[model samples]
Target: MVLLEHPLHGAGGREAGPAAAGPGARGRGLVPGLSLSRSLSQQQQPRLGRRDFRLVSSLATTRKTAGRGWSIRALGHLAGARPRVGPARAVPSCMLGCAAAAAGTSSPPRCRSRALFRLTAVSDPECSGFWLKQSAYREQPTVRFRYEVLFVATLGPGPGSLLAWSTFPAFNRLQEDRLRVPLLSTREEDKNQDGKMDLLHFKLELPLQPTEHVVGVQLILLFSYHLYRMSTFVMQSMAFLQFFSPVPESQLSMNGDLKLNQRQLLHHCGLDTRYNVSVVNGTSPFASDYDLTNIIAAYWDRNVTTVFSDPNPLWMTGRATDAPFIINATIRYPVEVILYPLKTA
Candidate 1:
């Protein structure tokens, strides 16, 4: 735990002194009375005014300053210069009446607090061929707060199908392994009571592959989708896209320098052939696209003099005619892909 010196440490360190007497000091341990004791030199006394006296009095009543040595130097600093002596008075009856009035005992019942439900979708509506509209609350006060909700979806059966899913990376890096999505909450509802509304909500989306059997699409519901909470603060939400695909049996050969035909080269490198090639595109269209052409070329030129150096070069044929070769071709597409930003109240 972090610790710091108390603001009143010096005051509490002073010594205690005998109680002073007279009109300026009266009524030992009584309300509206002055009890002055000095344990320190004048330089160590805490100079206080009338306002400070009232504040100190309130502090004394609240038991915040007791036992902690605090010195009062003079009563002349108080306003009105009134005598300190006073009767041992009971708390005012009117003050007690005021407290009772403010107790809220007779107020009419009302919804004192509100519970909120929010729905957020992250998708490329144009590519996904669907726009999402939440049946839940329309909007919420854009506050920074964390919450959990369920996520559910229904999939149409097909040979090669794509579905929207969400995952959190173990860390911020994209390549890190993902942990299973957490479950938040569950509920059962039957508005019609005919079993038509029966559904199970999930807190996370599960990626499901295509199946042979035909199944009619139905509503998928998620419950308790967890989200970071913020209150008037900016935060970032990172989620992973879950995908399902058939795995290939054989690994592709990365034996030697690869040489691709012009069309294959351009497509693989994500370059528009119509555009002029420049340093921005790198030495080769595909190679430049990934900022890897120079490095791959240098490595290939240095180590392997013939296209037949390895069992199977990526793009180069084993024939001597194809000597100069390319290895890994990486490309960047220009199109921007935007996913919906999830938001909650």
Candidate 2:
């Protein structure tokens, strides 16, 4: 039995009930040639910690100047028992648009609302997964990345003139005698002691023949990336690096950041595992499945990816004729500010 009033229109204007607002009197709006109508949800007791309870309302106004109709819909969340009736407060315009996405229905061009409603418990900690005890979104993700390495060093620019190695047994099998295993070591560090790794220290030494001289380097590192927030996003991503020089290089040192790259917007709510697949089919028996060209092309086609951003990679000359080509790399995973949409219960 609550009465609602428009802010722009004075108390002398027409009023509407809580449950239903019928067509208002003519010339009810602040505008000279406009009419207004509004409807509000009936009060009800919402089930606690269950499915969401949406308080739906709509306003439709006709404009004589534009010869059009404008519609506006609002959605409020109701939780627990029936809300206690109190003084009504004006809701911001942005909050009114909260239900617009859920409504999916609009009048011609839509109308604006100057109505107000007393918003009670709009969200519940237990139902929204934000404060749940076992919820993944309760804390920062303890990301565990599985890694695989692949490399190709070109001795010369001519075709079939490169040496390659891979951690994949099938890929190594396909390489046959051309396979060159390097001495590799890796270690991860938690800089701030927050139980999450901050960076990885990687070193690799590839033995070379006295006549071999490396003029180009290509490397691929695959990782299983994920985020547990509004949505549990799981994906297999890669950091691809390529460097070429006319002169033979002694060593390559890289300090880079492996950051997430998103092409399409992720879902506001749901589990997203669309890219949860191996970047390279390690168990495949065919050589085409392990082709670098095919792998890079497929990885880029994904909506989400990881890239290695190294603005300054040091390439030192002078191999000393017998020293193995060395690769020293430091890849850091910096903290990122993720903006996630919160759902009203």
Candidate 3:
């Protein structure tokens, strides 16, 4: 889940314009090679089932708006088959009015025509679960089962997107396990008003295969921030795991009753070229158990020398167009003042 990025490329975007004006953005637009990094932290974020804000096509306006916003169509190779997408959709500016009215503001912000709605992601979208139904039950003699947990993501109103994620719960005949969630890429964001990117569009992978006739299971999702960690564990997936048994040890006893242990190792090879190559093999890492963690860690870790090549040369880019004020244009500070500095006259 190492999403290499430029500072302005984060969902926080450039801190200057109204469209991307938030607390987190420090630079205006993309600062070439200005890298923003997210780390694995000990502190955890809480995840329930439903903490998302859904975006609906505002019915107030007669003009069509539903099929205009962005939606995720491809979830990479790990998400199994791409879910059938219905239509492109977006929420309108009137959302501000409704939000204000609920807040007891004397007068709500008036809706505008040209540009509105800041695209946001919604978690646990029923459609994701429905796709699993099609994959699991619809196909007779189905061996593969897949489920998805959606999260509210913010596609930059002007630029950038922060992709947070949801959970995948799997159950079968009293057997259970968590599937691996792979993030091919991340769209960093600043969801909190604290002024930094705290959100991301983390495309995850949860694919499974059942060995028997499928029995329906209620999928429950909890929100989590650690994609790299949880995906590595891959605990409790019952659909594909018919049964799990631990390996037993045959001990060779020494004179003092001490035991010596030995195990077999598998050999492997992978894509060698750095980023210039088309595919970064084993780009996504997952751990099924402690041993798997070591294997995966060794695989993805640079300098392992056992499999992967050295770390790829980092590359970052920012959009050429500067994000402009789309919300309250009048309140915007001058671009020169925000992005440029003054010297003694």
131-192 in candidate 3: lDDT tens per residue? Answer: 12111111011011122332222223322222222331221111222222323333444444
What TM-score should be assigned to candidate 2?
Answer: 0.60
What are the runs in model 2 whose C-alpha is more than 4 Å off?
A: 1-145, 339-345
Ranking by TM-score: 2, 1, 3
Please provide, for model 2 over 1-345, each residue's C-alpha lDDT reduced to its tens digit, 9 standing for 90 to 100: 222232222122322221122343222211211123322222211211111112122222322221112212222323333323233443332222212222342221122323333222243232232233331123243344466988888999788788889888898888877789998888888889987887778788989999999998988887777676567788888778788999999899899887877666565578988898989888999999888899999889997787888636899999987799988888777654444444537
Better by lDDT, candidate 2 or 1: 2
Q: Which candidate should be chosen as best, given lDDT against the real structure?
A: 2
lDDT of 1: 0.22
Alpha carbon deviation, residue 245, candidate 2 (Å) = 0.7
CA displacement after TM-score superposition, residue 173 of candidate 2 (Å): 1.7
Give candidate 3 misplaced runs (Cα > 4 Å): 1-97, 101-103, 111-115, 120-137, 142-345
TM-scores, in order shown? 0.17, 0.60, 0.14
- Best-fitting candidate, scored by TM-score: 2
Worst 10 residues of 2 by lDDT: 44-53
